[model samples]
Target: MIKPADFDFHFKPDSHWQWVETIALPFAVPEANINGIVYLVTRPMLGVCMCDVTLYDKITDLWEDQLYVDNQQHLPCPKSLTEFSLPNGLSFKVIEPLKHYRMKYEGIDETSFDLEFFGLHEPYDCNDPNMDPLAAARNGPAWDSSWSGHYEQTYRIKGELVARGKRYKVDCVETGDRSWGSRPERDNASIIWWHAAFGENLAVHFFTKHDIAKTNEFGELVSGYILEDGKVYGITSARGSQEYRKSIPIGGQLEVTDIRGKTFEFTYSTTNCAYWAPYPAVTYLQSAMRVNHNGRIGYGIQQLVLSRAYLGRNREALLARY
Candidate 1:
């Protein structure tokens, strides 16, 4: 179970300790052949915050010359996560911990936003004590070895955005997450975090472990939850496969069984994709996808992280293939 205090920074004694709050919001302008993603990450442990806004023009279909990034470091850290404004013109105030939050960003070149996120359901605890012992044992090491606590929630976001002298109304449902612990830099296993929402009634979030070097292997589901109507169900079993263009993920499919014995299958096609490194040792493909569940369509995002060490070991053959 998650409580109000979990939203605050959990500073450990180690120098590598960190608290992370991050979100990726997707927006599009079909008439202009543009689909864009906005990413924000805050690490109070390091007294820094970063914001990145990238716009993808479908006509050119390239990530170059379409990026805006801002970072503020060596600033004062907020005592609590409930309310704080960073030097980078990003401010966050929790209207209600774990359920509602208001965020605003300014001072970036021709990009600014004021948004409010309302949780559709209570935050899902990734480290539930009552989870299946086997599942927990298989997944705990990957997460527990790095972070002390983590949680994810789906939100209905509403607000406005001003980009390059034009204003666009913002309204969408997306997923965001929070994690706090000692984060060391090393050869961590590869992982995929993704989510899809079909209106306010149906949505799913998944975090899984994938071995990128072996492209044919299925991902091992770590933790996930399904929001169907007014209820939320824990995912009991899941198998996932991704379609890759060389080493980058282009699309994927997920089949899952919930605790209530219900099943769901979803397929997603990449609408736009870009790569970035929040930390030097890690780089990930952040893709915006058009997802299909049954006959319904929705929007989603995929984040695939691969360690630099793993890439270096396979560099010769991987580069030759690409």
Candidate 2:
């Protein structure tokens, strides 16, 4: 069982600790998607603490990401349960241990939100006791073991979002994910990450990690689950095939087989809401997609990230599409 203590910062001396918490909501009445991320990165050796808050608006295809870098010694590490205010008037407090979280933010612009997330499912640990989450490595020096741990859960979000002087009530399905470990420098890595949550008590999450230079030297990590009725099924393997137009992802199909040999197929289409992260280094393509699984209809997000240098010829194609 996961505890609220897992939400606390785990900064190791002389090492890097990155704690990221994110919630993504897909709304229908307003035909928009909203996502917020709180990132705290600590480097004890460097004595620095970097905090960031990112808000994404799918309707306007806009992204607002801000960063604050401070001395690690000045940043407060809450031992017990307490509210911590971040830069830009953003703060979060745990309302019900690991099951409920409340967040509020006031932006310099006329953008703000007061929201609560209620976990609908138990927390899923990406790395179990017998499994090595960072086992995917090349022949070289073991890839730094920076990606130490990851956990995620689906939630029901409720609250109000005030943007551009208008307030909109929010009631939708979302996902909360937390990952902590040393930050990997993505100079020569290629990645394919997939996440989906269906209304039928089902969700899918998986990723492919590889070296750009040696594409053959790669690993596929699967951490997916399916909930039907009151039973939870673990996805053992997932295979994905994508179609790209001018190097931009337009749509894709996925096949996930669980440990019980039950398979689910999903077909999804991408949206125009895309965001580029950290400027010229990374680009994240995310979409509020329509998903079809065995004729059952649902909605979710299809997101992808790629390093600039690793795209090669595909870079020109993506530029052309953009």
Candidate 3:
């Protein structure tokens, strides 16, 4: 169970290091065959806040994305029961403690949404004993002590999104994750981060950390749960591989085995490329994908990050091999 205490900000005001809080909401409109994600991130230590809204219009095979960033000195502190608003009309508020949240945005670029998220399952703590030892160790104190804690919970989102004058009802399953404490500076070691929610019943989140020079020596951590028929099963272990076309991720397969030994295999194909944001050290691709989990079709987002040096080496190796 998630208590209100869990929502408290874990960083100290006097700490001059770094910290971040993010709220991600992904939804699909089946009737219209459209999918989208609203991502909000705040780096309190840097006094920066950003919101990225991406919508995939399948009928036209087009992606519309708006990214808004606020780097002012008066950025709101991330705390329980507080609100954050941007000049672009994006606002986030905690309505009912740890169980409910509201997100609204009125963008000038023909993108807007008003959504409410209600938690559907108990929060799964990444540090719990139920996690795989190897996975837990990677996120443990020895790996990155500044990574204080992490937890995630699935939510059923309700509301609407308007893109290009078309309003679509937002009714789907999404997950909200919180990771606090000191965040490391962007480095070559951060390879990729993946997240997906299968309706209201299952969610998966994981990431790989590896040195750019030695990809063979990598550590992966997996955390999530399966909620079916009112029972929750913790994800014990997960293995996945991505297949890419050039720099874009086209498809991939994921196998997640729960503590009970029931494994779910998912085959996914990209539906739209949301954004490809490049940083000094890494390039990130966020896209919506059509996922088939044991024949039950769904839609989710696939976010990938490749270090610049690693990407160069990968391309070189491919050329030499071919």
Candidate 4:
């Protein structure tokens, strides 16, 4: 029912409440000045589910993992949304949607994090047993959402971060016919684990460092152009390169070579490693995050912007309230 092109180019929200609580963009640069911190929530559930809440700081360079919300046993699990945080005690919360999955995020201090009132939504995507990334990104989920999740852990070895966590990733992908010129590029994305957080900041900067793989062969393409106004650059026009300054199951240095050929670099770093399940059954990959653009010498990060919402639904709505 939601055609990608039918959406607004900038941002669009539904009614007084927003259909898009927040979008999960891979990584891109925008003219908009995203200098403050960003609070993001992701829930994967139609039945039992798990949610990830992340706190990303722009100016100070931080992306902290406050907590992981578990709602596997509760039906229509309810959660309170998170308001962005400022170090000076200037913090806030946004009202959750009335009839959709909502989030609960709050910070009581520097040491503790909490995810209150939270609910579960049906999977925005599922995959056909035969589809791939290019197809799935374009056609939406493939199979019916049946995967659950597990606990997470992280660490590093010889500069490379090792990790394992559980969350549904793709088992098989159907690569038959895809719609709207999007069959050859499909692959599974949803990961239960990524990399370990590092540095004093505990955040991952785009391509600076800590560039590891999220999916098997589809992780390094997550860079986009950003503008000076804190506005995010579009993905169709994004390009960059990376290097493997480190070694392990997955480690490398990343760079972006846009159409202009100009390049910016950052060092990716990670620590606090551990092992667990990649999801509920498959034991192929690990999940964790590290300090991005924080490594002095090497390492890196990656992502992609598959689809987007009308910009009107983005910051304008958030800014309108402030």
Candidate 3 per-residue C-alpha lDDT over 76-115 given as tens digits, one digit per residue, 9 for 90 to 100: 5444424667765667787876678888888765768898
Encode model 4's per-residue lDDT on 247-267: one tens digit a residue: 112233334333334454433
Model 2 misplaced stretches (Cα beyond 4 Å): 16-30, 33-82, 129-144, 210-221, 278-281, 312-322
| Per-model CA lDDT versus the true structure | 0.70, 0.55, 0.61, 0.23
Which RMSD does model 4 reach against the true structure? Answer: 17.5
1-322: candidate 2 lDDT, tens digit per residue: 3566776655555454433222233332125544444444444444444444454554223344311111122344333223667544667787886688888877755767788888777776656532323323233222224445566677777888776577778776656566556554455356655566665366665665533233322246445566555355666677666665544456778887766788888887765445545334555554556667878766666555666667773555446544
Clashing residue pairs in candidate 3 are none
lDDT of 3: 0.61
Best by TM-score: 1
Listed in order, each prediction's TM-score against the native is 0.86, 0.75, 0.79, 0.33
Residues 1-322 of candidate 1 have per-residue lDDT tens digits of 7788888766654546455554455545433434555555556667665655565543122345444444333446565668877666767799988888888878556877788888888877778755422246654532654445677788888887777667777677777777665555577667888888887889888888887776644677788888889577888878978877766677788898888889999998877666656566777777767889999998867788777887788787666654
Q: Which of 2 and 4 is the better model by lDDT? A: 2
Off by over 4 Å in 4: 1-48, 52-75, 78-229, 235-251, 259-261, 275-322
Residue 112, model 4: Cα distance from true site in angstroms:
4.2
